[model samples]
Target: MVKIYGHPFAAFYWKVLIALHERNVPFEFLMLDADHPQHGEAVARLSPTGQFPVLIDADHVVIESAAIIEYLDLHHGHAPPMVPADPRAAIEARQMDGIFDDYVMAPLSRMVFNALRDTDKQDPHTITVAQGTLDKSYA
Candidate 1:
């Protein structure tokens, strides 16, 4: 059985979930939390960076949402392809994916992280820059 280690609220987890749902893949969702017994250790074993949304299929382990999606599309024959078969089209798709991740999600993530920091530790200038980047990306 395929197992995914991640939190439900994380956007990257949602990205993996969307692909799994689209592929109609049956997977066991392991919600990772420091409070949960052994969950943190297990997640660490799967990911060196301790990042969420690690996919485990038997002895194979895959991390990173984009890589997970590509792995699914490649190995799971039943699923619709997430990436194009043609080299040129695939390159374009990956480029666009990076743009969205970097321009859109990156700034939003920075803002969220900033909000989570202690008030005194928070950087108003960083928040302002992130907001401006988000606005520009939207425009």
Candidate 2:
């Protein structure tokens, strides 16, 4: 059985869940939160960065949201692959994924992280830069 270690609120983790559901795959969810210290510790061992959304299939351990999604599609998907089989199409798909991750998600994540920091510890410069990136990406 496949086991996924992640939190529901995390976008990267959520992406993997959506992919699994879309492929009609059955798996176990190991949430990483205060109540699940063991799950977090397991992730700390499985992932280099101790990040969530790590997929454990048999003896294989996969980390990174994009990589995990591709792994699921290649190993478990039935018909059409999540990423196109065609070289050109695949490149385009990956390109867009990168754009979203870099321009949209990264900035949004930075803003959110900053928001979580204490007011005195928060970096206005970082928030401003992230906001600029978001604005440019949206434009």
Candidate 3:
């Protein structure tokens, strides 16, 4: 069985989960807190970057959501038929994924974390910047 070390609230983690689910790949989702001793050591052993959403197979370990999703698509033949048989479409999909990571996920994650810890600690300027990005992203 494959295992995925993930946190449900994590953007990248959920992205990987969605990919796996879309591919109908059977995997165990191991909910992990990056700071926890058990998860930290295991994640480090699996991922050189020590990141979440590490996919562990019986013999091979892979980190990074994009890599994992690509692997699943290659092995499972499970992606939607319209998901780009063309090389350019594949590139577009990857590019859109990167846009989400850089623009949407990153800022939203920071804002959420800051809000969780202390709303006052969140800079108003940063929120304004993120909101502008958000608006642009949706539009």
Off by over 4 Å in 2: none
Q: Give the candidates in order of TM-score, highest first.
A: 2, 1, 3
| Model 3 steric clash total | 0
Off by over 4 Å in 3: 34-36, 77-83
Q: Which of the predicted structures, 1 or 3, would earn the higher TM-score when compared with the native?
A: 1
lDDT of each: 0.85, 0.87, 0.79
- The candidate that achieves the highest TM-score relative to the unseen native structure: 2
Residue pairs in candidate 3 whose N, alpha carbon or C atoms collide under 3 angstroms: none
Candidate 1: worst-modelled 10 consecutive residues by lDDT: 75-84
lDDT of 3 by residue, 1-139 (tens): 7888888789899888887777777888787864657876898787888877898878888888878877667665456732356898988998998888888988897678767876567677777888888889878
TM-score of each: 0.90, 0.94, 0.83
Residue-wise C-alpha lDDT for candidate 2, range 26-122, written one tens digit per residue: 9999988899888888988889998778999999999988999899889995757777889999999899888888999889988998999999999
Candidate 1, residues 13-131: lDDT per residue as tens digits? 89889889888888998877766857778887778898878999999999988999999898764766877888899999899788778888889888898999999999999889988
**Which residue ranges in model 1 land beyond 4 Å of their true spot?**
none
| Residue 20 miss distance in model 2 (angstroms) | 1.0
